[model samples]
Target: MKTYHGSCHCGAVKFRIVSPEITSGVRCNCSICQRKGALMTPHIYSPDDLVIESGEDQLSVYQFGTGVAKHYFCKVCGIYPFHQTMRKAGYYRVNVGCLEGVEPLQLQVEVFDGKRL
Candidate 1:
């Protein structure tokens, strides 16, 4: 496992996550995810695995439908850093594009059928 640093587009929201070195990602086909088009971590993470380094107050959350998922983004920069999964409420998935040293487009991504959830 490795510790990874991530931040929003404007650096207004910074955080860290401990997970295996990221070699792949997930692309969700849900309505909201389709609009955002962000590549996310392949595995869900527990809250304990994530640490907010700074800008906690600058984070904004958006929810719709059943409101099971909580999409969190930087209020200042409009960049989504992570989100609470709808499949499991307290679990999270980090945005690969937001992580330092990660090239989201280079990742071999799996398509998730989130639209049916």
Candidate 2:
């Protein structure tokens, strides 16, 4: 597994995720995701595979609907770097934009039927 680095707009809330260089992305139609315009790869990883480099207290979480998924954002910049979905507990949906040295269009994106969920 290759490791990639990512951070929020303000350089706070940095993290790293281990995954392959090529990834499958996910596009969700959920209300918050749509508003945030999140285009992400569903690189689900165990908590051990993810490292929160800094600003642990600066992270904030939001939940809606069944309040199952925990959407985590940087409190300073309010950027949703990653989130935990109820459908896949103990794993996180890492935002593709957050990953360094990655081009958005290069990823193979799959539309998630979040609206029907």
Candidate 3:
């Protein structure tokens, strides 16, 4: 597995997660995703592989539809850096933009038919 560092805008929220590879990610064309412009990477880490270094209070959550997915954003900067959804249950969808030292184009993306939900 590989370790990746990431943070929210304004540097308020910082975190790390482990993935088998950096190139795995998903892109959804759902209403909320299209509006938010989120490109998600599946974060399947054990408790030891994930850490939130700061800014817990600055985070906000949004849920809709079946309320199974929890979208997490920075309250200060209004950037949705990650989300927990029913699709992956315990896993998280980490926004690729939040990762440090990585370019969005470097990842391979699979399209999720979230619009049909």
Candidate 4:
């Protein structure tokens, strides 16, 4: 596992999560995802694997569709940094774009058919 530090645009929310190898991230064609244009790295992590370094109160939550995944973003910056995937039995999916010094577009991407739902 590798550690990645992430934060919102305005640096209001900062966090770290352990990811496996991180060769790729998921690009879902779902309505919300398409609108947000976020490259998601849905790493399977136990709740303890994530550490919120600061700005917990600056975050806001959004949910849609089946309301399974709870997307968390910074209220001030409006950046989706991570989400709790209820569809995957309750694991966290961190937004690799928010990670420090990481170029999300350089990673291999697997597309999911979320629009079919």
Instruction: Please list the C-alpha lDDT of all candidates, in the order they appear.
Output: 0.94, 0.84, 0.80, 0.84
Off by over 4 Å in 2: none
TM-score of each candidate structure, all chains considered together: 0.97, 0.91, 0.87, 0.89
- Higher TM-score: candidate 1 or 2? 1
lDDT of 2: 0.84
Candidates sorted by TM-score, descending order? 1, 2, 4, 3
Show the lowest summed lDDT stretch of 10 residues, model 3: 41-50
Worst 10 residues of 1 by lDDT: 43-52
Candidate 2 TM-score versus the reference: 0.91
Question: What lDDT tens digits, residue by residue, belong to model 3 across residues 1-117?
Answer: 778899998888888888767676778888889899877875545446667789879899899988887888998888888887666565577888899876788777789888887
lDDT-superior candidate, 2 or 3: 2
Off by over 4 Å in 3: 42-48
Per-residue alpha-carbon lDDT of candidate 4 for residues 1-117, written as tens digits (9 for 90 to 100)? 788898999999999988777778898887888998888885667688878899999989888778888889899979998888756746788888999867887899999887776
lDDT of 2 by residue, 24-104 (tens): 788999788788888877667789887899988999998888888889999999888998877887678788888898777
> Which candidate should be chosen as best, given TM-score against the real structure?
1
